[model samples]
Target chain A: MSAVTAHGVIAPILVPLLTGTLLVLLRGSATPLRRTLSMLGVQLLLGVSLWLLLQVADGEILVYRLGNWAAPHGIVLVADRLAAGMVLLTSVLALFAMMHAIQGSDRRGRQFHVLFQFLLMGLNGAFLTGDLFNLFVFFEILLIASYGLLLHGGGAARSRAGLHYVVINLVGSSLFLFAVGTLYGVLGTLNMADLSQRVAALGPEDIGLVRAAALLLFLVFALKAALAPLHLWLPGAYSAAGPAAVALFAIMTKVGAYSILRVYSLIFGADAGPLAGLVDPWMLVLGLITLVVGTLGALASQRLALLVSHLVVVSAGSILTAFGLGGEAALSAGLYYTFQSTLVVAALFMLTENVARTRGAFGDELRAGPMLPAANLLGGLFLVLALAVAGLPPLSGFIGKVLILKASVGAPAAMPWIMAIVLITGLLTLIALARAGSTLFFKTETHARTASLPNVAKLVPVAALAGISLLFVVFASPIHGYAQAAAAQLVDPGGYLEAVLGAGATDNDADADTDTEPAKMAEVAGPRRTTVHSPPDQIMPAH
Target chain B: MEALIALVIGLLAGCGIYLLLRARTFPVVLGITLLSYAVNLFLFVMGRLSIGVPAIIEPGRSAYADPLPQALVLTAIVIGFGMTAFVVVLALRARADLGNDHVDGREP
Candidate 1:
């Protein structure tokens, strides 16, 4: 409740936005200066995000109201354990992505530093925003920056995949707006806390419409998360992105998963009157399918980049399945899995780039080539990342999967399916990655020309990320405890609701105004109708 | 009036989906544009389509159209505009580089 802590919530967002703007203005400046600035910016973001995470680590929900507006009427940024953790994860990922890009990828296009910073801004904002409309706005910002990054290298494959990525997201954005409109029209509010209160008070008649809106919103997030049937756009898009961009893009799918967890828990949680458990069945089934399909895709992919992309899909499936199982333990394990997968996949993307670069003429196509320079170092990094991603023993992936499986035991019906799909998928991922590793690194043949060693700068980031996953395994206890606390809060959103809407605001009062109105009220009242009304008492200040 | 608005939204979305399914990039982009238009209108209509209500809140006014959706629509419009511009340029580049406009970037 201190002023500095309140202001600290916004710092993660402001640092990146200001830095990106500065970088854009300094576009004419030399690359070294821009690189230095971006490095400083991401480092600052990491520091601030860690601070926020520490502040919220004790299960505190920090709500920052913009422009001194009260919770309902003005924009609010709520930082709880989940949001802060996500910001921390993003900043960490962004730092390494920045480092990798600085080494070489930045040279491929203009404003690489600026776009990367803006992408970070979008991500932090999306994680922090408490208003649904603002979430849409932030999503657009992220997608636009992603579009720029997707085509940074300027090749046929990038442009083609970027086209599909852009068009599909544009449609998704449209759908997002439609869903927002429907929710607003029905509930008469956009604030998460207010929506939760209102939604719980909704009568049976309004349940159907609300459910439809919720599902529509779910579809948008699912598309972003790249779940099955909606996942066609992901492999092409992620594989097409440059190494650095793909490393950062790894977190983008988590944004989708985060939204689903946040919105579903807030609005349609177990307490939700008629719409409780609405998404559970669908998410469970579809998530399993996504796992099956993604694993198959990974198995079938010949290119290392596509293989990593499919792994991303597999991670999504696992997280969604965990989410679908529905409990504090399951959700907490899912969160841990999310963090582990994001870091490992990001490292894999960077490693794949290095591996490809070291194989002259083969270019990460999973084919044998000249023995790469520094083969031992690159191979070691690749093996660690590959094992981590495939959920092998001694890595964080195994621990995360074990936690998820242990949690799924409570849901007997889903337990068997979740176990079967996850274990099977893990096995397939192991096979695919091992095959890729042997072909690309082990089965190497000599040629007249030797592939060059990867740059120290590029290799450092990959090593750092991989090292962190190892660190995660060593420090699994505390992180698991944190995830458990975060999941507990998610299940009981009272802390979040109270923090945003103020204490003493209960659903009983909300129910008084819960009489369902027909959609034709606009027509009945006519366009010109005017009447006197008094605004509700402003319970909270923006600043 | 509500029915009419719904019909329009449905029609636009349907056409947009149809165009989106086309093999060529131009039509797909066009499809996205149409879908965005439909979405913008859908957002606008969420404010309940009042014509004579002041856009700004008055001291004593209780019966005003919901203004929040207008703000949302405006934001959506600007975003859609920028996105359309980017996609158009991207499609043009794809055509020039790949020598075709197929969404998959190659001929059947």
Candidate 2:
């Protein structure tokens, strides 16, 4: 199975899944206590993740159920390295951001820490859950908390943006429901492992059903990930949502990417027979185009916040391309890039907030000019992240991109022209970042900029992230090893496949004996043959 | 049968998107509501559209619709209700917060 137990697997998701109710009930009592409890919760989550990562580092997979029911009959929580890694990453970003939240100068929500904590709980849970239904539930939990936080300070701009953000995600959630619902209808199973085994058995005549379901699911995720063409709502929505929201969102968007990575590579890989000609090739093409369009959008954006948001789109698209094209090296590279891009974009957005404060609120949009003089620290951090984003040399972003390019070079399934497009896109990205950097930091200003007030909470994390970016070259080996292990775990479906079919801890050896993955997984895992379904109002999927 | 439902839903979804592209708040809300329904229907059709068979299992019957989708739809319906309520309330707030109810928050 995966590197850990279902007990460990369910811990990350369950702790946060139900924590929101308590957080809401406890809201607005005392600022100090709320802040302390929230931070404690986040740190405790981090500790759980650290333990999970440590336990699973040697390649153990864990599966857990909410109640006592097994797959098809009950909800399952699956934790592979990839899913666990995301949990760790998301927890790190959210914890740091929450710390930044408690440093007060601006008017945050009255119970900002409470809402923020619930939001983190939701986020961590979403990343770790093994089931599709609960994925959506956690998604709502996160989104609902986001709603309160986004409109927490209650500004005209934030409220307006929150409306768009809330509505759009709601649309996304609806789409997710629709896709999952349809998949269940066709497969008769909701457990991901069960589906992975059974979905392949749906005969050739039913291929059309598979394609439609895959597309629906992909679309919902794409909208969340802000893959190009479908990414219409992101820039304005993210830019106006407040500093904490935008920074935290950089990692959140990757959950969509992570979902695609988990679903397609692991669960959907079982059913790739029908998807052979259609999904894979287009995914590569779409990914490349998304990368290009996203970078171009970032370049086109005049405002700093919007540019950072669009950059998230660009990086997500990069991960999408890498994940879709299944080369050993490419997948590893993509995972590295995904991690790098999330961290970089977060740092960049934090810088954007600082830049905005110094320049005053944009009357229309962020203008290109040397708004602040001698802003060397700010400029250097901005430039480093920009170059890293553009895939410049000696940086982690560049290394990751090079690995992706090297992986794509020989694969003939994609056109030589597709690689050309990605390359051209990379070059264009460098040019765009250069121009924006010059405009914002390097160029001379006609208008005198307002001085920025110091906030150690914000500055420490931003500086720490920049320092991490600088150490990309030095830290290459360890990072690569982690990425490699994570990728290998992903590509080889054995750990996960065995986990579901294998009996309890006592009989785990019974499964290992029948090591033939394909032959062992070919069974039909139809729904639990029960006469009664949980009645309409009480029904919940086994996410 | 699935294609027909998907097609009808697509048409309505297109209309909703058209309305969403407008500058007025009320039309955008209407569009979102309609589009949501279309999405729900389209997703249901993706399950291959079995007619009148209960997804729940029965004794001595091998054929049944998928219950997972039904469960998901139930949640979606509730979440959708929450969404509509949020949007409608936001609309009212937007009306109250801003002098006019324009889809674009800014008048200029």
Candidate 3:
């Protein structure tokens, strides 16, 4: 591999870190300068991520070791198809979010550009890191930035929502540490590639503890993904966020889904004899319940932003339901749905803000309001976004939902329920969006247009997002092809293992050590890996 | 020693969870703080309790305590500290802005 390809794995994390620090240092500088710098940073991030995606397009997993430390001993950032694609998705979403924030939302808050860059850094770090503990650190980074962004405008409602968001995530972080501890206690490594090998070799004595740890980790990710029973904080927290912040927050939930796909499929995969497919049944049931609850919530919402937030939950449900089906095709379908839904939901958040801007005192409420000045432009934008969100024909949402439904045929028993809930949720979303549209656009108080026209500059991002959704429909084949490749890479993580550790590393001496020490599980677990690595030749690869 | 550590962790977690379920923001923040303390201790113990052992590699050392969990706990402590500070400030702000301390921003 060329030097750039070898070292490019760290660029996505470094670029945003440097840019965020620069923005913070230059806080007293001109807003225009800061805005320009932030935009350049996000645009550069998008470029770097796209380049990384292309590098890994042929299914090469690139591992960047921090401090030249080898796997199982030091932190590494691995970029495979899934990680690269998710980072690219975040970069694309961040660019549009920056476009919207620069239009004026940044002026309403302190350090908007700084916080935005850190959020990107956190997201990229989370996607790329190969260490499970590093994943927890990145989760904290993103959550802290999100807390600041969510309360950027600072209101009673936002404060209320921010409290719940902060506290719940704090608890989640605690749970995450507990899980990490248990896993490390039982298996002697935090590196995911290493853990995948060790988890499979775990003795029967360690199975129950590892199972609990894995499930606890799942619960935390589910809370982040806004799956049911644990999804109570999403609508309130999302709706209360500032427009640009909410737009970026769309990918944050996908981070949870990404973790679920990564950890569950990699470590607790079909190869792990006792713990194989541990989360599959739970993922499906909770996913369907989340769909039902979210769709009903969307229908009951009295405000446009709340409705959009509920739609986000609906998308999460759909994507996870696809993932829960557990196969290459289902995962591919879920990935495609994730892409389109993120873009469309982000556009919906911005559109709600635009509508609220045009309606003066009746900000985003679904009740009848004064005639909007740019009714035609705004209404048309809302129509396309609503259609895409509701999974109607000729839009990307329809294509995604259809792909998921087609993939569900693999699981015979869950297929019917999946079909029923997914279709019913789509129908309910349609009804909700229809009601929100007419109430905002048609049910005007009077024909006399009183509210001022929204800035065309602000509408550009919304229009771009909607236009991309349309483009998604046009380019579904190639994009879905990429998703399929990524899914295939994910299901068979042997490449990931080989790239991070050396070739044939899973058959290392530690596997034999663990097998003989089953009786003294606790005492043996701590020093076994260390003993295996005492001879330097066995630890580091001959790179 | 293991039993004592486990008991402490269980007690702290039980109390933290109970406080977290309360309606007030202050108690909720306190609950999170207590829970984090419990988690940090729990993580510290996961490395296997060893006394007077080197945490790093050295000449002629055959036994060393697992140092990664200490490193992990240290990182967790710093993050938990930052989050607690932020949440505390946020709780005060929520109280000031909402004219109440209830998590839902209203007297129930």
Candidate 4:
């Protein structure tokens, strides 16, 4: 790869940070101009992320050192197939969500465009970062932006929901710091690839503390992923957010799942001596519980938005369960499902807003509403999305679930529970969505009729999401192939380590070749050693 | 000294958790702040406590405190401050909008 192409990993983080900063500076500009700028920025991000995905599509792990600093010393960004694909998924969702926002909702809050861009920056940063501290920073970035977005409209319900969301995340953040501190204390390195090596070579006396830190880290991620007991803050927060914001929020939960897959498989995978497979059983049980709880919540929801939020939880659960199964096939299936669920849930959130608007005073409540002027079009879109979300036949959701089920059959111990819960959840989702659809479409009151037709512009984004979801089913083979490649890269950490910490960093000869360089260079420089810390010969070129 | 630092962290964390479990938003915000402080202290201690030890590298010095954890703690404190400020504002807004200071906006 060329040097320019090697710089692609940082582009995902830089593009958004620069753009969001520009938007903040231009906050006083005309609305149309600001909107155009925001849209253009997101379009550029989509192209950049897609190019990155193609770069890593063949399972090449690309590591970009910030400030040309080497790993385990300076921070780095690693873009393998998994990270690249996630950035692409996020950019795609952001494009549609931005399209939906420009329709009207962007006017509801101060710096809506600014917050949106920063949120993207944070999400991309989280996916691409290779250091544990940088991961925490990115998490805070995304959570802060999400806090602003959630309270965009500023209502009683939103404020209430936002309070819980903010508090819970703050606590989660504290726990994350605690875990990170413990890890650094034990391993003395925050770079993930370096941590992987240290974890494998850990002394027996320190294993217990390292294991504790690892599990604590998992707990923090589970909170972000909204897994079961940690998921109580999701439904209320998601349902109460503005429609455009909620649509974008769909990918936020997957950040948790992505972190789990990355940290566990890399640092604590089979190579971590006694700490190997420590999180596997906990992940499986918590994921299953999250699935059941989410389904039950969906069934009991009286509002369309709340039901969709529960479905988000269900998607998180399914993804985690697949990942917890621990194999290339299972990880690949989970990745595919992550893509499908994010797209479908975003579309559903936008559709919910349109449906509520068409009903006027009746809103999104499960009770009967007035006859909608665009009933046929809205109902058709809802039916398709609901089927997709419920994981029914002839949709991408079904393909994802089937792939996961097929992967699960290999694990005899957990296969029955996985199959049973997944199938039952699908059934319950179908019933809940069916009932929701009927109430919104067929049970309209005759006394009142909504005269204004739903805006075709708003429906454009919804239709686009639904269309891509359908395309996901049609193009399942290529997508799943890409996912398998990503999973393959994830399972083997040697390449990742070499890419980040330089070649031979994982082998026994690493110390002789590289680690002693600073000492040797210092001795050679003699009295000038203080100024000779990182001579040109010592700096590793960006790969 | 290590024992004192550990006690401080434990006591702060315990009080923070207690406050966090309260039903009101004000107390919860305070709890989050206290918890973040405890976390910051814990992170600082992770570098191994030292008195008058230089964090920066210099010539002829064989011993120095690990600078990485101090950097980590600095970042955490800045982030925690921003979050605490944001949450405090959010609590005020919730009270103003919902007409209550309850975490749920209404009494249980």
Candidate 5:
């Protein structure tokens, strides 16, 4: 590839990293200066991400090798349709969330701009990396930055929630290491493209070990995505975090979903001999339970913030269920739904902050409050977001749900159950949000005091996000087409592998060359079959 | 060697889980630290316990030890250290602010 295209691939990661470093070096500067710097950097990031999305919209997978080292030897960043789309979404979310933070929350803590930049860096890095080990490193970067952001305002509740969030993630990080290690030990490669090829060629005895490693990786991701039974940490953390922080976190769960989709489809895909259908059954069962629990949690929640957090769980469940159903159509629909829910939930969080500001002491609690100043405008925004999140008509959420339902028709066994759970969750969400809405906005008590006016800067981002979500409805067909193409790319890993490695990397000779190393390890480690090597030329490109 | 490494990992994980389930914050922090140690060692051994082999490759050499896992383990160790430090400070802050060190930040 030429230098410009190469830069395009790495720009998403480099821009944020360099910006974060600059902000840290320029610490103690005026708050206005820092905010200006952050805004310029994020806006540039958004431009680059949009350019990348357009570049990859034609089914091209862009792979940039770091330091001129080839795929298997050096770290490579791959920007295919899925990765590019996610980066674009993240940039959009980051821009609005930063705007919201700049309105006030950035003043509450030191280095808020610096931490936000680093968090963006980590997020972009995670999406673009084509190596499994690099993913872990990026995950840490994001987690550490998130720890700072979560505790930014310095409250009792935030610190308490940050404690649980940090500890659980630490444990999850450990498990992630174990899983990567095991997979590396068995396969002798950490590059994702090479791993997929090697996995397909694994001998019978090696399947069990690889299967175990795959399942462990799934557990780590499940914890991150807040699937049922493992979702204990999400509600507490999201509910207690500052509104801007929580809004940005709307994309964080999608990272887990993205990883699951990437790893499962790429590594243990249909070509894998014994591991083809390993995670689908488990994902289906857990997904259904998560949907039920999330809806019930929303219904039973006493606070609006917690209710939105539960809706996040419900979105994750919906995406996972579509993934478990396992077809190109369903996967496409899941991607579309993922995009819709992320934007709407983020907007909802921002709206919650504004509504809470208007309620004075009532503060987002589901109790009677005085008439909110500008009740009509704020109430209208909340109504639109609530309707979208509840998957009602005339919004992208309804279209997304329709796509998922239509796609799942192929999976006869799961179609009925998935539809039932999804519709029920939608009804529950509508009821809960409607009740909270009326209690906060419509009900007026005589003795209640009026709160201060909401900030225009704060309100603008929420309006912008809601507007974009509505636009998704206006342009659903083209967006769904893009999602369909992205899902097709996901199902077929060969294009990605070719883009990362060389053109003929899929041939049997390359597989044989790498197979011998793992076979030798297996022989020394256990009673496993061994394969022979052809030559090194078939594997790595010479300098 | 494999059996011994597995035993050590199991022991560390067992202790980590026990402490993680405790009601107090300090033990939970310690639990995460121990678990990270176990994970780091686990990643290190993924290269299959070769001794006296150079990690770097030579033109005619065919038996160099794998260095990728070592690099990965090193990265994990640094991250784990940073995490431990941050969480310790966070625990201290929680204790100071909430006036209790229970993992939930309130007296149980």
Candidate 6:
């Protein structure tokens, strides 16, 4: 509640950011010192994330206006329990990945640390920002750092994949910019909370072209989210990137999901957008379809990292699909599963790195040796994660699915086809993981005297990811409860808007001023709130 | 008027898609650019274009064109530029390093 709390909220994005910048500035110093600084940055972000999570649990939403300006005019950063939870999760995994990247490398560790920090900064910033424009800015921050991290090994394979990765993301970012501009043209505002306020008052009567605009905007997001038909770029991009990079990027899709979460709940309000009743429902269906396609890709692929990372894509689709189902609990499960899958995929990526690095020279493709039936620790972690990915029983993943299924099934609001796909995809996912495990990890080493691979630190990140999944299972209820509250607040956006913008401040010209409207109309789109403005017949006048 | 604009967009989209389906990376990139332009113009026209008035208004000026779509289209144009550059660089890199300009992955 103090100024310190606001500082805390903003620090999650800034801590790693400053750390990354500092590390980059100090690159090529003493190796031990560089390693220490890299570890320090990760540890620092983890601490900040923990504090932010606790603040959210106290039932307080933190909104930090950059330079103390108001919403609409100035960029706003927010941390509800939901945003904080993601920050906490991302920070933990990032720390592990940073450690793995540093320890695994034979070169100086500082540059790696810098990229990792900036990447984390992007993730945190994307989650925390309340402005649509700022989201694009954060996407750039993440991608710029990602470009460096992706090409870390600097070889034929990484370089080729790196080109594709940069291109795909640049294209995605362009789509994002276009969508934002279009939406801004319609709404006359860019702040998400304020946009929600204005958007409620907009319809085809006032803006006949909204239908097309909305669809286009959603298409932009869909591409970023890798929704089914738009997901063709993901497997190649994730697969081509190296393991540590892939593991970090595994959670990158969550930025897209979080934007969906923000937009669906805020600007579009729960009931609006081009897709209408079909939006969330169709998203759910798309999620299931993506799940099937991604898992099948995993099963069919020969590479270890590619197979595991595709599961990350499937799980992302599943999260969106759950949202499509439309109950409070179902949506909450979707949120929780996003955090859970981030961990599971991270673990799987780490394990892939270990196996690949050990089999180096031959690591370009995911080939196997002649013998098998051992390496319990690494293999067991992989099995558990694979099971988690498939939504098997007693795990947190299954809990998310069960909650979604129970909430969605027989619900007339959602398309029946979507529910069916979720069920079918669940089955297919299991088959996919089983085939992958049987093919790659179960086989023995081809060469007995391949010589020891460099650095044991490579194991830490994936292990951290797997460890977090186990923690997710153990702490399912609390996490689920937080997601539920976050979803509830999402459903009733008034409180959130007020917390960020302020109460009763919607009448002012928000674009002209920074300090007034946001603090006053902090909360927006009260639950099932409808502005009963008289509907117009093509409110948009003809040319 | 709306139908005409839509038709133009549809035609551009069709041509873009046809080019996109080609085997070469450069053609696909070109197709993407053409499609982006068509889409941008379509979005611009979607604000229900008014020939007589610009969106920006001065004091005491009469009603203007809807301002929102214009802003959106402008941003989209800049972003499209960014995408085109990225694709161009990627295509060049693919050709230089891999010795092939096709989008297909090299088999191990």
Lowest summed lDDT over 10 consecutive residues: which window, candidate 2 chain A? Answer: A516-525
lDDT of 5 at B93: 94
Residue range A413-528, candidate 6, lDDT tens digits: 56476567777877877886777666555655656435234344565566666666777789988888889888887777777777766755444444323322222221221111
lDDT per residue for candidate 4 within A426-446, as digits (tens), equals: 999999999999998999677
Instruction: Write one digit per residue (lDDT tens) for candidate 4, span B6-71.
Output: 999999999999999999988899899899999999998887766666666567765566677778
Q: Highest TM-score: which candidate? A: 3
DockQ scores for all the models shown? Answer: 0.52, 0.30, 0.59, 0.49, 0.54, 0.17
Interface RMSD of 4: 7.4
> lDDT by residue for model 3 over A313-367, one digit each (tens)?
9999999999999999999999999999999999999888988988888899999
| lDDT accuracy of residue A420 in candidate 3 | 91
Candidate order by DockQ, highest to lowest?
3, 5, 1, 4, 2, 6
Best by lDDT: 3
TM-score for each candidate, following the candidate numbering = 0.96, 0.84, 0.97, 0.95, 0.96, 0.81
- Tens digits of per-residue lDDT, candidate 5, A1-543, equal 567887899999889898899899999788898899999999999999999999999999999878766677678899999999999999999999998998888889888888898899899999999999999989988888898988888899999899999998998989888899888888877789878878877777778889999999999999988998998899999999888888889989889989999999988888776788679899888988998999999999999999999999999999998888877998999999999899899999998988888787889898888888889889899999998989999988999899988987898888899889889888988999999998888888878887778777788998998898899999999999999999999988889988887777767655554554445542233212222222344334221
Tell me the whole-model lDDT of each prediction, alpha carbons only.
0.87, 0.69, 0.90, 0.89, 0.87, 0.69
Please provide, for model 2 over A1-543, each residue's C-alpha lDDT reduced to its tens digit, 9 standing for 90 to 100.
Answer: 443444676676555544545566776566676666666777777888877887777777776766756544677676667777777877777666766666652246565665666677677777767677778888887888777777766768776777778767776776677677666655555666656655544555556776787788888888877777878777877787667666788877787877777777766673345664345666677788788888778778877777777888788888888877775677788888887778778878777776666655442144554356446767777778888887888777888788787778758757476578767878887877777677766564566555555454676777777677767667877776777888897776767766654534213333322331322122213333221122333334322
lDDT for model 4 comes to: 0.89
- Candidate 4 residue spans exceeding 4 A from truth: A449-451, A509-536, A539-543
Q: Could you tell me the lDDT of residue A442 within candidate 2?
A: 55
- Model 1 alpha-carbon miss at residue A305, Å: 0.7
lDDT measured at residue A234 in model 4 versus the true structure, 0 to 100 = 99
lDDT of 1 by residue, A1-543 (tens): 778997999999899999999998998998899999999999999999999999999888999989867777788999999999999999999999988998888989888888888899999999999999999989988889999998998988998898889888988998888888888877778888878877777767778878899999999999999999999999999998999999999999999999999999988898787888789898889889999999999999999999999999999999999998888999999999999999999999998888888776789897778887787898899899988998988999999999999998998878888888899899999999999988987786765368887787789999999999998899999999999999999999988988887766554454324333343444222212111111344433111
Kindly indicate the candidate among 1 and 4 with the higher DockQ.
1
Q: 1 or 3: which has the higher TM-score? A: 3
Q: Which regions of candidate 6 fall more than 4 Å away from where they truly are?
A: A106-110, A271-278, A360-374, A410-420, A441-456, A505-543, B1-90, B105-108
- Error in Å for residue A50 of model 5: 0.4
